[model samples]
Target: MDRDEAEIVALLRESVRQQRMWLMVVVGGAVVAGVAAVVLLPGARLGAPLALAGVGVFLGVLITAPQRKLLAQLGLSRERAIELLSRADIAGRTPEQLRERQAQRRTMWRVVTAVTTVIAVIAIGYVVSQAGNRVDDNVPGSGPTALFGWALFASAVAGITAIVGFVQLSTFASLDRAMSAEGDEIAS
Candidate 1:
């Protein structure tokens, strides 16, 4: 109802929208690359889809740093506004309830991160296996060797991206923990 509430809501909505857009970009890139790989590389296994998927993964990692920064800024702004309201005694009887809600949110985030880490690990394993299988199926000629090499390179890129994603996820989890701790301290 107030200006601060409106601003917080706007920022939250914007963050969600940006994240959704990022997901679309990642999915679209993977789809396009997969199609191209299938059509362009006749004998190649894994096709364009997998290759595009690798590219998509890499781009997602590249974008995550900026995304994290945006999230941190949004969180800090919101927290500071809440702190200001609490200090001014304007939040009335709901401060404890708000703290409880934030704690629940932190717990939910931890669960989400844990699930995401597992899924990412599974995806990396799947991609690696698919790449290896494709490389093995190709005959022992120069062309096959070249294709295998390209596939290997792409797989490596994807692996690095996966690593980055894991690291970012961990960083976010830690940030969440730290924020929760700080919130608890403030509430006390």
Candidate 2:
């Protein structure tokens, strides 16, 4: 195997590892939420745990979307893909093809990051605006505190999404540049 292929394999392995970690988080969150829901079933605090769980699930879904597309592109299931990666098999991918896909994904993630950054800004702005509002202590989840919590949660999630996407975009951009340089050196 060439250096480029080795790098691609290593990168894919790292990606699969990260995805699995995220999956674990999603499952762990769901389990925690389930327990919380059962314990708080008779109280007004049920919504908070459930809402947090929903956000976890949402983030998991969003993060897995690119993996799903890549799986489709490679015509492999998740388990099979991981297995192939373990064996250092890239499902018949060429460096050029991978670079092209990387470029396309970088472009897509840049757009997604931009959108999420905007959302984070808006959510943070709303949270700040609501910070000074008078609170009704009689309500459980209907007070300013609850509103602030939810808004802060939303903004945090959006900020996380933006950061993740931006990091991926930057990584892909760097890899593409390195690959291009390698190709140029090889050609010369």
Candidate 3:
């Protein structure tokens, strides 16, 4: 309600936004690395595209956490600002108003979580499938060098999936918190 509190909320929002921008940078770098790997590494052509795609998917997972944090913070801040404005105007609140606001916030969070989860799952599955294909390409007649290349591709995909899963879990936690906050608001 106070000026100080408003300032702090603004700062927090800004910090989260900045973090999201930085994540974009990291994602771009990963894409470049994936391309370079394909071009420079011997027999890496089959693996490069898969690695790049995996990196892109993993970056989405990584960005989702910060995105959720920012959304939560922004939603709360907006709600607080509205409440403060209402108080200043001496406007009476109705149950419908409260319910609408709660519903809007809930919908926002639900959409974000559902979309991100779907994307992450699809990406993970794609990476896994690509790795399997690469392995199959390394059949006995494919030569020892191709087999080694396939092994590297599989390892890279596995590593990317592990990291993406961890990030996705963190994002899911943020979504849970947002949902809990909405529930508490409705109860009170």
Q: Write the per-residue lDDT of candidate 3 for residues 15-35, one digit (tens) a residue.
A: 656767878789678657656
lDDT of each: 0.60, 0.73, 0.58
Q: What is the lDDT of residue 21 in candidate 1?
A: 86
Q: Identify the candidate with maximal TM-score.
A: 2
- The C-alpha RMSD of each candidate to the native structure, in angstroms, is 8.7, 9.8, 10.3
List, residue by residue over 1-188, the lDDT tens digit for candidate 1: 23475565555556657778888887777668756876787656663567657876778777565556754765555566446444544345465665565567656656655665565566556556655444333556424443444455555555566566556556656756776797789979
TM-score of 2: 0.53
Off by over 4 Å in 2: 1-92, 136-142, 145-148
- Model 2 weakest lDDT span, ten residues long: 1-10
**True-structure lDDT of candidate 1:** 0.60
Better of 1 and 3 by lDDT: 1
Report how far residue 143 has shifted in candidate 2, in Å.
Answer: 2.5
How many clashes in each structure? 4, 0, 0
- Write down the TM-score of every candidate: 0.35, 0.53, 0.35
Scored by lDDT, the top model is 2
RMSD of 2: 9.8
